[model samples]
Target: MSLPNAVDYSIIICTYNPDRRLLERCLNAVSLLDTAGLVMEVILVDNNSSSALYTLDYVQFFLNAVPHSKLIVAREQGLSYARIAGIEASVGKYILFFDDDNEPDPEYVQVQKRLHAHYPHVAAWGPGNVNVDFIEGVDDKLAAYATEAFQDRHEVQIGYSNQRTWQGCYPFGTGLCIKREYFESYALLAAKGKFSLSDRKGNQLSSGGDVQMVLYCISTGAAAGVAPELKLTHIIPGKRTKIDYLKKLTYGTSVCYSTCLLEIFPDHLATIKSQMISERKFAFKVLKKYLMLFFDPRPKKALKLAAYIGAVAGDYIALNKPVPSGVLWVLKRLKAI
Candidate 1:
């Protein structure tokens, strides 16, 4: 595989007070032995983490092992803040975003080169993220990750199994990679204590910030594609793997998605809403799958599937609702929101 001769490729991760054990696995993956040739740096933005969970041993090891990585502490509240800080600090020509509770595949770094080589005009690429449902034993490095617990990948063109469509106007964050210039283009501006990306605060809670970025990218007519080769294992904690979490995730996804779609086109929302309502066939299909899982006899798998389908239902519900309540509430709540 021919890697890009470009100067920078920053792997930016935004993390909260993370599950230490899971984070350890991800840090290990990020600092793998074969990462030497990739022209990149790992920028872990600490989201106000007091101790900086990526420990000194982990930091020193990766700095020594991975070739390029720098740990900088950023005191910010949300994932968006951490990500933005990482972007501003990076010198990489391309930036790759990672969540804390993920273990990237060993072939991950190489995929960046492979994709860029194929489409020089393409601004972004999302990898195939295999979701790990649950891991047992607190400190066990060899925890189990169920491949069956995956989510929708929007790009199937590059062999990723995103459920949305072969070609997407937006992509997922787990495997999301973009040119550094693209990230820098949308810096948060402030005036008398206001910001340019200011409208995003309410949208972040509903989980559309990443999707919103992808939409912005695609709408601008920049080339975007999805590749399955760049991989990451998204770990699902015990709590997140429950029906209760599913309900919350579902509602949040719906609210967030609605907020994103409406933002991209203020006037076309009604048309989009109508079209979404017309796609009840797909929504029903999603619902039926969840109902069937209840009788499927596997507690773990059933619960996992339930959460996913519930999220879809929530999306449809938000679309069909006469008024978007949470959207308004969120706007009113966050001061800088």
Candidate 2:
């Protein structure tokens, strides 16, 4: 049922105002992939970057070096929109999404092909071994958290499951691989105005699209997993290593948590509602418990408090309810309102 010239994989790199050095390194790594006998295409989607990045010398050189490669300018300025553009343009059986800063190993494509053949039931999968290559050194206090943040599946095994949540089972956005058909379905939903999460637009770190995708996969009876053989290096710039950046990232994820979950798993409405209420209550308790700590000189305690505040805000937004007086008082006391 396959066309004679059908591509096996489509590698989609979504970027917006990317760092030139990081992009060059990413392109070089992609160019070195062992795709000798494999039919593949590289789709670099520029998500409303300020300049025409495809016209750059290094990018032009890369486009010439790789066969079946092209650049697409997504007028929409969001990772979700860029990825949807790539999905619509792809003709491969499997679609691989790599962030602009991700560098796949030489054997990445081959490993993915093998995994697809071996685990036909897995609709989405990601790299279990995601090494971080930080351009500059990080603070000693933030080093451990930064490492944990960047790496995926540090000690998890490779297997497929229908878990609804993305704790240890689902993949993130760094090097996410999925069946083209599944993504086509996702795109159709987006087209219908059902999918509205614009992940990481501009510099605002509102993220949930990847989690939505994983949950959608599970909802559709498809298994998702992580494979250690699939490897990639997530390049981290010095700016993202700062405590403030991490705090913002945490808050962003927390704020989008409830909305993403409810959107994908509507059938579990009652259960999710109950969970949200419990979480909101717990968040208030956490804020109260850390009221004094928020004033500490160290920013670490404030970061922890911000995550709980974000969760409470997310729940209130999702449920269409106003913040309770007590919670508002606590938030005000912590100067987080």
Candidate 3:
């Protein structure tokens, strides 16, 4: 069948000084794909990252022969800025946003292109991960080559998109592709400027801009889904995979939840509360199983536990006040999360 513009897609990696060796490997993965002329180009938006200062000495060295675009030291420091810059510079029929830490499957570009071609009504899509593992320089082909994972019972995966495929809250940010027209069509209502919650100084420790962007697309008339066929091995740092890692990611993600739900699904807080209470009961059943790890695991575990506690509290807080940060302010603002 005819594909979406026969591979007229652009993949962008919003990086802040990605190490040269690692960056090269990531570039090669996408550049060497067998998409004929379909995988048009890649954009490496350097977010003022001086990781490989010498990389600029030879632009072709880092870009590695593909028809690519480069943004040297994006003035804004946040990931959102880098993403916004990439979207602005893209000339392709579809825009794919990949993380610097990700090593995309060879089929990544082709799969997304196929779906967009077939489902002309869909506005956007996300990537799939075979499993969660993070180790540098380790050859991870078996882990990198697939389209499914077996998850623990308690952790739970929410917001399934059978028609969209893949996992994670509807459409995830990593390996996510959005039609540029979504931005152009809804910019007046969608706020196509940088991410919504990102501070001027780039402190994204507690916000979710990617989710905000897609929610905006949904708010408008664009359809979004997941493409399980387009896979990637998300590099979860050792430190980030620990029990504590979940807490921070979840807590930081809380802000994204508030920002997205309020704008996209105003009744999301009620759902979270129902989930927290329901999931907590289920989580408690598994609590006995994980008790050994908590004898005094690490601050990460403590942080994760704190974040869950914060999330349960945050949910109710967000119900009234739409922002996530302080409990007192939430009480004052009448927000739950």
Candidate 4:
């Protein structure tokens, strides 16, 4: 796993049974990136894809096409584990964590390079636009997110961002850039059995790895930020537009939110209790706003409220039991945990 000594940026794309068309678009965009004199490397981690990726030439095409790029197989079935492998294998000063379906803006690298040079802590993520090209009958909720959630184009320091709002400064493992040291520290912590959360385990919606990493950075004097210039277009397929998937995603989001809260405030019962009380108050306020639906309900409005309830439940559950992490090294070798 030895790498060249002078690599500037390391891009890690973690994928599991991805759509070939979407992946191709992502790689196409990667091919066109203007490095601007900075040396870069791209590490593609295949998270136990059952598809005939290598035999079908999808993996081989990139090996020959993208410079300094190689495919690594992460037998583990979780996104967090795949990312850990990438962080361990990468050899660059800075690293970008990208999903397989993400298409970065051309100036993404250039802007990120500039920001990391100026900002010392070097932990951050950029917003992503929704690419609805392949989607049919695009869901209103999904479309609204692209324009509304990531609409802001300014740079916001992490702690100061709207933590209460869903569209906050938190990074979601897409187009997220951080110094290599931060990722190394995160991997070390996980290896030491300090923490664990499922940020998409197989077909499940559970997610918290990115959030936990950011929390770690904040705890250790690193401040993450929202760098608008490092934007990407997240390819939204029809599958993710389904109601069932959305519900699951909403639940996962809530669970992760609560899980992170528990991890951060592991100190005192009073502090955790107060935060939970505040959370319930916020949930009650949301329910109150949509209470009229009991008499005259709109499907969309009802669905939205249901998702909120799911999150509240997740918060409660997390208080009692949090995700555990161990045997990661053994899993890396055995491909099962």
- lDDT of the candidates, in the order given: 0.57, 0.81, 0.55, 0.66
Q: Which lDDT tens digits does candidate 4 get at residues 1-337?
A: 4456799999999988888877887888888888978989999888888874565476688778877898888887889899998888889998888787788888889988777777765466555333334344565655554323223233433322323223455565668887888889878878886776848888877777877777767667666657555667777677766655554565565556666655644653455455554544654555464555678655455446545554555555566732222212211222111
Best prediction by lDDT: 2
Better of 2 and 4 by TM-score: 2
lDDT of 2 by residue, 24-84 (tens): 8999999999987799999999998888887689989989888888898899888899999
Tell me the RMSD of model 4 versus the true structure.
Answer: 7.5
TM-score ranking, high to low: 2, 4, 1, 3
Clashes of each: 3, 0, 17, 0
Alpha carbon lDDT at 303, candidate 1:
41
User: Which lDDT value does model 3 have at 24?
Assistant: 57
Q: 38-89, model 3: which lDDT tens digit per residue?
A: 6476677777765543345444664545555454456767776666677777
Worst 10 residues of 1 by lDDT: 137-146
Candidate 4 backbone collisions, by pair: none
**Per-candidate TM vs. native?**
0.68, 0.90, 0.68, 0.80
